[model samples]
Target: MALRTFLLLLLLLAAALLITQAQGIGSSASDCCLKHSQKAIPSGVVTSYRLQGPESGCLLDAVVFTTKRNRKICASPTDGTIQKLMQHLDKKAKNDKNKKKGQTQRPRGRAKKQRRQQV
Candidate 1:
Protein backbone atom coordinates (compact mmCIF):
# COMPACT_ATOMS: atom_id res chain seq x y z
CA MET A 1 0.00 0.00 0.00
CA ALA A 2 2.83 2.41 0.87
CA LEU A 3 4.67 1.63 -2.41
CA ARG A 4 1.49 2.10 -4.44
CA THR A 5 0.82 5.49 -2.84
CA PHE A 6 4.39 6.65 -3.49
CA LEU A 7 4.20 5.59 -7.16
CA LEU A 8 0.90 7.43 -7.67
CA LEU A 9 2.29 10.60 -6.12
CA LEU A 10 5.39 10.39 -8.34
CA LEU A 11 3.25 9.95 -11.42
CA LEU A 12 1.12 12.95 -10.50
CA LEU A 13 4.21 15.09 -9.98
CA ALA A 14 5.65 14.04 -13.37
CA ALA A 15 2.38 14.88 -15.09
CA ALA A 16 2.24 18.29 -13.43
CA LEU A 17 5.79 19.12 -14.49
CA LEU A 18 5.07 18.11 -18.09
CA ILE A 19 1.93 20.27 -18.20
CA THR A 20 3.78 23.27 -16.76
CA GLN A 21 6.63 22.93 -19.29
CA ALA A 22 4.20 22.59 -22.21
CA GLN A 23 2.28 25.71 -21.16
CA GLY A 24 5.51 27.74 -21.03
CA ILE A 25 6.88 26.58 -24.41
CA GLY A 26 4.94 29.13 -26.54
CA SER A 27 3.61 31.41 -23.80
CA SER A 28 5.76 34.39 -24.81
CA ALA A 29 4.01 34.51 -28.20
CA SER A 30 0.49 34.13 -26.85
CA ASP A 31 -2.34 36.66 -27.32
CA CYS A 32 -2.28 39.49 -24.79
CA CYS A 33 -4.61 42.07 -26.29
CA LEU A 34 -7.71 43.00 -24.34
CA LYS A 35 -11.16 42.45 -25.83
CA HIS A 36 -12.46 45.92 -24.93
CA SER A 37 -11.22 49.48 -24.38
CA GLN A 38 -13.03 52.35 -22.69
CA LYS A 39 -11.59 54.99 -25.01
CA ALA A 40 -9.38 55.36 -28.04
CA ILE A 41 -5.68 55.92 -27.71
CA PRO A 42 -4.52 59.11 -29.39
CA SER A 43 -2.18 59.05 -32.38
CA GLY A 44 1.55 59.41 -31.67
CA VAL A 45 0.94 58.82 -27.97
CA VAL A 46 2.12 55.23 -27.88
CA THR A 47 4.98 54.78 -25.47
CA SER A 48 5.64 51.21 -26.56
CA TYR A 49 4.02 48.38 -28.50
CA ARG A 50 4.32 44.76 -29.57
CA LEU A 51 3.24 43.09 -32.78
CA GLN A 52 1.27 39.87 -32.44
CA GLY A 53 0.96 37.54 -35.41
CA PRO A 54 -1.77 35.03 -36.28
CA GLU A 55 0.40 32.26 -34.88
CA SER A 56 -0.17 33.83 -31.49
CA GLY A 57 -3.86 32.82 -31.71
CA CYS A 58 -5.18 36.36 -32.19
CA LEU A 59 -8.19 36.70 -34.55
CA LEU A 60 -6.04 39.06 -36.62
CA ASP A 61 -2.52 40.43 -36.57
CA ALA A 62 -2.56 43.07 -33.82
CA VAL A 63 -0.49 45.99 -32.71
CA VAL A 64 -0.72 46.06 -28.91
CA PHE A 65 0.16 49.62 -27.95
CA THR A 66 1.09 50.98 -24.55
CA THR A 67 -0.12 54.57 -24.54
CA LYS A 68 1.28 57.52 -22.60
CA ARG A 69 -1.66 57.15 -20.21
CA ASN A 70 -0.42 53.60 -19.48
CA ARG A 71 -3.51 52.13 -21.15
CA LYS A 72 -3.17 49.19 -23.49
CA ILE A 73 -4.88 49.38 -26.88
CA CYS A 74 -5.10 46.84 -29.65
CA ALA A 75 -5.09 48.12 -33.22
CA SER A 76 -5.35 46.44 -36.61
CA PRO A 77 -1.96 45.48 -37.91
CA THR A 78 -3.11 46.06 -41.51
CA ASP A 79 -3.01 49.83 -41.02
CA GLY A 80 -0.03 51.35 -42.83
CA THR A 81 0.62 53.99 -40.17
CA ILE A 82 0.64 51.37 -37.44
CA GLN A 83 3.02 49.22 -39.46
CA LYS A 84 5.44 52.10 -39.90
CA LEU A 85 5.28 52.99 -36.23
CA MET A 86 5.87 49.37 -35.23
CA GLN A 87 8.95 49.19 -37.45
CA HIS A 88 10.32 52.43 -36.01
CA LEU A 89 9.71 51.24 -32.45
CA ASP A 90 11.39 47.91 -33.23
CA LYS A 91 14.52 49.69 -34.46
CA LYS A 92 14.53 51.98 -31.44
CA ALA A 93 14.19 49.06 -29.03
CA LYS A 94 17.05 47.20 -30.73
CA ASN A 95 19.27 50.24 -30.53
CA ASP A 96 18.46 50.77 -26.87
CA LYS A 97 19.22 47.11 -26.08
CA ASN A 98 22.57 47.34 -27.92
CA LYS A 99 23.47 50.49 -26.02
CA LYS A 100 22.67 48.79 -22.70
CA LYS A 101 24.76 45.76 -23.68
CA GLY A 102 27.71 47.99 -24.56
CA GLN A 103 27.39 49.93 -21.31
CA THR A 104 27.25 46.75 -19.24
CA GLN A 105 30.39 45.39 -20.96
CA ARG A 106 32.36 48.34 -19.61
CA PRO A 107 33.19 48.89 -15.96
CA ARG A 108 31.12 51.70 -14.45
CA GLY A 109 34.05 53.50 -12.84
CA ARG A 110 36.05 53.37 -16.09
CA ALA A 111 33.04 54.69 -18.05
CA LYS A 112 32.61 57.59 -15.66
CA LYS A 113 36.33 58.46 -15.82
CA GLN A 114 36.31 58.31 -19.65
CA ARG A 115 33.27 60.60 -19.84
CA ARG A 116 34.90 63.08 -17.41
CA GLN A 117 38.13 63.06 -19.41
CA GLN A 118 36.26 63.72 -22.69
CA VAL A 119 34.43 66.66 -21.15
Candidate 2:
Protein backbone atom coordinates (compact mmCIF):
# COMPACT_ATOMS: atom_id res chain seq x y z
CA MET A 1 0.00 0.00 0.00
CA ALA A 2 2.79 2.43 0.92
CA LEU A 3 4.60 1.78 -2.36
CA ARG A 4 1.47 2.29 -4.33
CA THR A 5 0.76 5.57 -2.56
CA PHE A 6 4.26 6.78 -3.22
CA LEU A 7 4.01 5.88 -6.86
CA LEU A 8 0.67 7.66 -7.15
CA LEU A 9 2.09 10.83 -5.59
CA LEU A 10 5.04 10.73 -7.97
CA LEU A 11 2.77 10.29 -10.90
CA LEU A 12 0.60 13.19 -9.79
CA LEU A 13 3.62 15.47 -9.48
CA ALA A 14 4.88 14.56 -12.93
CA ALA A 15 1.48 15.23 -14.39
CA ALA A 16 1.34 18.62 -12.74
CA LEU A 17 4.76 19.56 -14.06
CA LEU A 18 3.86 18.38 -17.53
CA ILE A 19 0.69 20.47 -17.48
CA THR A 20 2.51 23.62 -16.37
CA GLN A 21 5.19 23.29 -19.03
CA ALA A 22 2.76 22.33 -21.76
CA GLN A 23 0.74 25.49 -21.13
CA GLY A 24 3.85 27.61 -21.78
CA ILE A 25 3.59 29.12 -18.34
CA GLY A 26 7.31 29.64 -17.77
CA SER A 27 8.50 29.97 -21.36
CA SER A 28 8.24 32.61 -24.10
CA ALA A 29 4.51 32.95 -23.49
CA SER A 30 5.24 33.67 -19.86
CA ASP A 31 6.74 37.00 -20.87
CA CYS A 32 3.39 37.83 -22.44
CA CYS A 33 1.06 35.53 -20.58
CA LEU A 34 0.32 36.48 -16.99
CA LYS A 35 2.86 39.28 -17.30
CA HIS A 36 1.21 41.03 -20.27
CA SER A 37 2.90 41.58 -23.65
CA GLN A 38 2.16 43.89 -26.58
CA LYS A 39 2.57 44.06 -30.34
CA ALA A 40 1.80 46.69 -32.94
CA ILE A 41 -1.60 46.38 -34.62
CA PRO A 42 -0.17 47.83 -37.84
CA SER A 43 -2.03 50.01 -40.28
CA GLY A 44 -5.25 48.63 -41.82
CA VAL A 45 -5.43 45.70 -39.42
CA VAL A 46 -7.38 45.15 -36.24
CA THR A 47 -5.50 43.88 -33.18
CA SER A 48 -6.80 41.14 -30.98
CA TYR A 49 -5.47 39.70 -27.70
CA ARG A 50 -6.49 37.33 -24.96
CA LEU A 51 -4.75 35.87 -21.93
CA GLN A 52 -4.05 32.13 -21.84
CA GLY A 53 -3.58 30.18 -18.63
CA PRO A 54 -5.25 27.91 -16.09
CA GLU A 55 -8.54 28.83 -14.42
CA SER A 56 -6.67 29.81 -11.27
CA GLY A 57 -4.03 31.49 -13.36
CA CYS A 58 -3.24 35.23 -13.37
CA LEU A 59 -4.87 35.66 -16.74
CA LEU A 60 -8.17 34.14 -15.73
CA ASP A 61 -9.50 37.62 -15.09
CA ALA A 62 -7.59 39.31 -17.88
CA VAL A 63 -9.57 41.42 -20.32
CA VAL A 64 -8.92 40.87 -23.99
CA PHE A 65 -8.59 43.74 -26.46
CA THR A 66 -9.61 44.34 -30.05
CA THR A 67 -7.76 47.40 -31.28
CA LYS A 68 -4.84 48.58 -33.40
CA ARG A 69 -1.22 48.58 -32.22
CA ASN A 70 1.19 45.82 -33.09
CA ARG A 71 2.38 45.48 -29.49
CA LYS A 72 1.43 45.78 -25.87
CA ILE A 73 2.33 49.05 -24.23
CA CYS A 74 1.07 48.89 -20.66
CA ALA A 75 -1.22 46.44 -18.88
CA SER A 76 -2.72 45.88 -15.46
CA PRO A 77 -5.16 43.07 -14.91
CA THR A 78 -7.16 45.16 -12.45
CA ASP A 79 -7.01 48.69 -13.72
CA GLY A 80 -7.76 49.45 -17.38
CA THR A 81 -9.16 47.60 -20.37
CA ILE A 82 -6.65 46.73 -23.11
CA GLN A 83 -8.84 47.98 -25.95
CA LYS A 84 -9.10 51.47 -24.48
CA LEU A 85 -5.37 51.67 -23.93
CA MET A 86 -4.56 50.74 -27.50
CA GLN A 87 -7.07 53.16 -28.92
CA HIS A 88 -5.63 55.93 -26.77
CA LEU A 89 -2.11 55.17 -27.93
CA ASP A 90 -3.14 54.97 -31.55
CA LYS A 91 -4.81 58.32 -31.25
CA LYS A 92 -1.77 59.80 -29.56
CA ALA A 93 0.61 58.47 -32.17
CA LYS A 94 -1.55 59.71 -34.98
CA ASN A 95 -1.75 63.14 -33.42
CA ASP A 96 1.99 63.27 -32.85
CA LYS A 97 2.77 62.30 -36.42
CA ASN A 98 0.34 64.87 -37.74
CA LYS A 99 1.92 67.56 -35.62
CA LYS A 100 5.38 66.64 -36.85
CA LYS A 101 4.30 66.59 -40.45
CA GLY A 102 2.51 69.84 -40.04
CA GLN A 103 5.68 71.43 -38.78
CA THR A 104 7.57 70.10 -41.80
CA GLN A 105 5.10 71.05 -44.50
CA ARG A 106 4.02 74.44 -45.79
CA PRO A 107 1.24 76.02 -43.77
CA ARG A 108 -1.31 74.43 -46.10
CA GLY A 109 -3.47 73.87 -43.03
CA ARG A 110 -6.22 73.03 -45.49
CA ALA A 111 -4.70 69.62 -46.30
CA LYS A 112 -4.15 68.92 -42.60
CA LYS A 113 -7.73 69.83 -42.00
CA GLN A 114 -8.83 67.36 -44.64
CA ARG A 115 -6.77 64.55 -43.14
CA ARG A 116 -8.18 65.16 -39.67
CA GLN A 117 -11.69 65.16 -41.04
CA GLN A 118 -11.11 61.89 -42.87
CA VAL A 119 -9.60 60.28 -39.81
Candidate 3:
Protein backbone atom coordinates (compact mmCIF):
# COMPACT_ATOMS: atom_id res chain seq x y z
CA MET A 1 0.00 0.00 0.00
CA ALA A 2 2.88 2.46 0.82
CA LEU A 3 4.62 1.80 -2.53
CA ARG A 4 1.39 2.46 -4.44
CA THR A 5 0.81 5.74 -2.54
CA PHE A 6 4.36 6.96 -3.34
CA LEU A 7 3.91 6.23 -7.03
CA LEU A 8 0.62 8.17 -7.11
CA LEU A 9 2.24 11.17 -5.48
CA LEU A 10 5.06 11.17 -8.04
CA LEU A 11 2.56 11.09 -10.89
CA LEU A 12 0.66 14.06 -9.50
CA LEU A 13 3.87 16.09 -9.18
CA ALA A 14 4.81 15.36 -12.78
CA ALA A 15 1.36 16.36 -14.02
CA ALA A 16 1.52 19.69 -12.20
CA LEU A 17 4.94 20.49 -13.73
CA LEU A 18 3.69 19.67 -17.22
CA ILE A 19 0.65 21.90 -16.80
CA THR A 20 2.75 24.85 -15.68
CA GLN A 21 5.16 24.38 -18.60
CA ALA A 22 2.30 24.40 -21.09
CA GLN A 23 0.92 27.66 -19.72
CA GLY A 24 4.39 29.23 -19.93
CA ILE A 25 4.74 28.25 -23.57
CA GLY A 26 1.31 29.62 -24.46
CA SER A 27 2.07 33.01 -22.91
CA SER A 28 5.41 33.27 -24.71
CA ALA A 29 3.95 32.47 -28.11
CA SER A 30 1.48 35.30 -27.82
CA ASP A 31 3.70 37.87 -26.07
CA CYS A 32 7.05 37.54 -27.81
CA CYS A 33 7.79 39.62 -30.95
CA LEU A 34 10.63 38.87 -33.32
CA LYS A 35 12.11 40.55 -36.43
CA HIS A 36 10.35 43.91 -36.01
CA SER A 37 10.84 46.59 -38.69
CA GLN A 38 9.81 50.20 -39.22
CA LYS A 39 7.68 51.88 -41.88
CA ALA A 40 10.21 54.60 -42.73
CA ILE A 41 13.28 52.47 -43.43
CA PRO A 42 15.37 55.35 -44.81
CA SER A 43 14.68 57.73 -41.93
CA GLY A 44 16.23 55.42 -39.36
CA VAL A 45 13.11 54.71 -37.30
CA VAL A 46 13.54 51.09 -36.31
CA THR A 47 15.10 50.17 -33.00
CA SER A 48 16.17 46.71 -31.92
CA TYR A 49 15.42 43.36 -33.56
CA ARG A 50 16.11 39.89 -32.22
CA LEU A 51 15.57 36.24 -33.04
CA GLN A 52 14.01 34.05 -30.40
CA GLY A 53 14.33 30.29 -30.33
CA PRO A 54 14.04 27.37 -27.94
CA GLU A 55 17.58 27.78 -26.65
CA SER A 56 18.52 31.49 -26.87
CA GLY A 57 17.78 34.94 -28.39
CA CYS A 58 20.21 37.18 -30.29
CA LEU A 59 20.06 40.82 -31.42
CA LEU A 60 20.25 41.35 -35.19
CA ASP A 61 22.40 44.49 -34.88
CA ALA A 62 21.38 45.78 -38.33
CA VAL A 63 18.77 47.72 -40.29
CA VAL A 64 16.14 45.71 -42.15
CA PHE A 65 14.48 47.28 -45.17
CA THR A 66 11.02 46.64 -46.54
CA THR A 67 9.90 48.06 -49.87
CA LYS A 68 6.41 48.87 -51.12
CA ARG A 69 6.52 45.64 -53.08
CA ASN A 70 7.14 43.77 -49.81
CA ARG A 71 10.72 42.91 -50.49
CA LYS A 72 13.05 42.44 -47.52
CA ILE A 73 16.69 43.50 -47.31
CA CYS A 74 19.19 43.38 -44.46
CA ALA A 75 21.66 46.24 -43.96
CA SER A 76 24.71 45.98 -41.73
CA PRO A 77 24.95 48.18 -38.67
CA THR A 78 26.66 47.24 -35.45
CA ASP A 79 24.51 49.67 -33.47
CA GLY A 80 21.75 51.62 -35.27
CA THR A 81 20.37 52.49 -38.72
CA ILE A 82 22.99 55.14 -39.27
CA GLN A 83 25.63 52.66 -38.29
CA LYS A 84 24.31 50.28 -40.91
CA LEU A 85 24.62 53.02 -43.51
CA MET A 86 28.20 53.48 -42.40
CA GLN A 87 28.82 49.81 -42.86
CA HIS A 88 27.60 50.07 -46.46
CA LEU A 89 29.89 53.04 -47.06
CA ASP A 90 32.79 51.02 -45.71
CA LYS A 91 31.93 48.24 -48.11
CA LYS A 92 32.11 50.74 -50.99
CA ALA A 93 35.60 51.71 -49.86
CA LYS A 94 36.69 48.09 -49.92
CA ASN A 95 35.30 47.68 -53.41
CA ASP A 96 37.20 50.72 -54.61
CA LYS A 97 40.42 49.27 -53.19
CA ASN A 98 39.79 45.98 -54.96
CA LYS A 99 39.17 47.73 -58.29
CA LYS A 100 42.37 49.70 -57.96
CA LYS A 101 44.30 46.51 -57.19
CA GLY A 102 42.95 44.77 -60.30
CA GLN A 103 43.93 47.58 -62.72
CA THR A 104 47.17 47.58 -64.71
CA GLN A 105 49.54 50.42 -63.69
CA ARG A 106 52.94 51.38 -65.05
CA PRO A 107 55.83 50.22 -62.90
CA ARG A 108 58.03 52.95 -61.38
CA GLY A 109 61.23 50.86 -61.62
CA ARG A 110 62.65 48.33 -64.09
CA ALA A 111 60.32 45.31 -64.08
CA LYS A 112 60.35 41.80 -65.52
CA LYS A 113 59.00 41.45 -69.10
CA GLN A 114 56.48 38.86 -67.81
CA ARG A 115 53.73 39.74 -65.33
CA ARG A 116 53.85 38.00 -61.94
CA GLN A 117 51.66 34.89 -61.71
CA GLN A 118 48.38 35.58 -59.92
CA VAL A 119 47.18 33.24 -57.24
lDDT of 1 by residue, 1-119 (tens): 99999999999999998998778665654546654343555557877987676566555567789888887788877777677778877887899999988986746564433445554
Scanning candidate 2 in windows of ten residues, the lowest lDDT window is 36-45
- Residue 112's lDDT within candidate 1 is 38
Ten-residue stretch with the least lDDT total in model 1: 110-119
TM-score of each: 0.48, 0.29, 0.35
Q: Largest lDDT belongs to which candidate? A: 1
Off by over 4 Å in 3: 25-31, 41-54, 57-119
What lDDT is reached at residue 20 by model 3?
Answer: 84
User: In order, how many clashes per candidate?
Assistant: 0, 10, 0
Model 3, residue 34: distance off in Å is 5.7
Where is model 3 poorest over a 10-residue stretch in terms of lDDT? 43-52
Task: For each candidate in the order shown, give its overall lDDT on alpha carbons.
Answer: 0.73, 0.56, 0.55
lDDT of each residue in 54-98, candidate 3, tens digit only: 433334444444444555545543447546555565575688889
